[model samples]
Each structure stands twice: as structure tokens, then as C-alpha cells.
Target: MAKHARPGRIDPTWPDLPDGEHPVSELAAATQGSLSPFGDVEFPLDDVPYVHPVTEINR
Candidate 1:
């Protein structure tokens, strides 16, 4: 028998819809040129502590 799917649940066989209607797709499009966790987009480079070159490290 086929299993029923519902909101807040995951289904392995979900079909891909057009970008306009897909939740993740729409989010990606919205942040296409900006920094977003869901994307590999980079932020405007200026000065960020964590990203700075490692100057000192203990052995």
C-alpha cells in the first residue's frame, strides 16, 4: 500500500516542481546574489576576524 504524506514530514519520493513553487528554490532565487547560509555565496569582503589569515597558532 502507498503511504500518505503530510506537512512537516519528509517523503523520499517527493517530485521536483518549478522553481517558482519550490520552497528552497524560491529562497535560493531570492538570495541569488547575496550571502545566505543555504548558498555558497560570499559576503562582501572587508575584514572579518574568523576569516582572517591565521597569524598565531600553538603547536
Candidate 2:
């Protein structure tokens, strides 16, 4: 029988991601360029110190 997947847990099948520290503004600027500027999406850049990755998901 197959085991049930648990909530708030990553599946074993998924690739492992390396953890590292980085400034939020740098990350935001890097990703924002992926979107079309003409579209209705915006990610304004701000110079801030390091932000935790887990907490950034909620933003």
C-alpha cells in the first residue's frame, strides 16, 4: 500500500533545494524581470537586509 502524503511537508519525489541566505530586494529584482512589465503585475525593489526564505512565501 502507498503511504499518504502529509500537509506542510515536501514529497520525497520532489528535488531537494539548497538553502542559502540572500537579500529580499535582490531576489525580488531577479524574479520580477521574468514577468511582462506591460502586464498588471508589479514587484517593486527595496533595499533591505536578509529575509528568511520560509517567511518570504507568504509575501
Candidate 3:
């Protein structure tokens, strides 16, 4: 099975989608800008550069 489920349909809210390419910044926004995978807190996108790759890479 695919480790990460690709969105069946791109979300319009994500202007970064549909084009089928996402930059590092756009990927973070798609996750609602979660800083940590721990689920306790979220960091603002502007405040945080990008969600750490290890956390999202396998998601």
C-alpha cells in the first residue's frame, strides 16, 4: 500500500495544487502548517520556516 495517501482531488483552497507540483512552502500550508506531528501544538507558517521534513516525509 502507498505509505501516504494522495488527495483524490486537489483542494481549491490550496492554490498550490492542481498544477501537480508543490514547493516546500506549499506543502506546509496543506497540512494547515503543523509544526510538530505530536498534535499538541501548531506553529504559524510565517513564524516557522516549514514543518520538519522527517515528520511529513512519510505521511
- After superposition, which runs of candidate 2 have C-alpha atoms over 4 Å from their true positions? 1-14, 21-34, 37-59
lDDT of 1 by residue, 1-59 (tens): 97786756867578778876764454556444444663554568576657556777778
lDDT of 1 at 11: 70
Clashes of 3: 0
On lDDT, who's better, 1 or 2?
1
For each of the candidates, give the backbone clash count: 0, 0, 0
Cand. 1 TM to true fold: 0.24
* Model 2, span 1-59: residue lDDT tens: 99897776966666555677443434655554455644654446365556766744665
lDDT of 1: 0.61
Residue-level lDDT of model 3, residues 1-59, one tens digit each, is: 65675677666575554576775554656456435655645445347555565644664
Q: Give the range of the ten consecutive residues with the poorest summed lDDT in model 2.
A: 21-30
Off by over 4 Å in 3: 1-17, 20-34, 40-59
lDDT of every model, 2 decimals: 0.61, 0.57, 0.56
Q: C-alpha displacement of 6 in model 1, angstroms?
A: 15
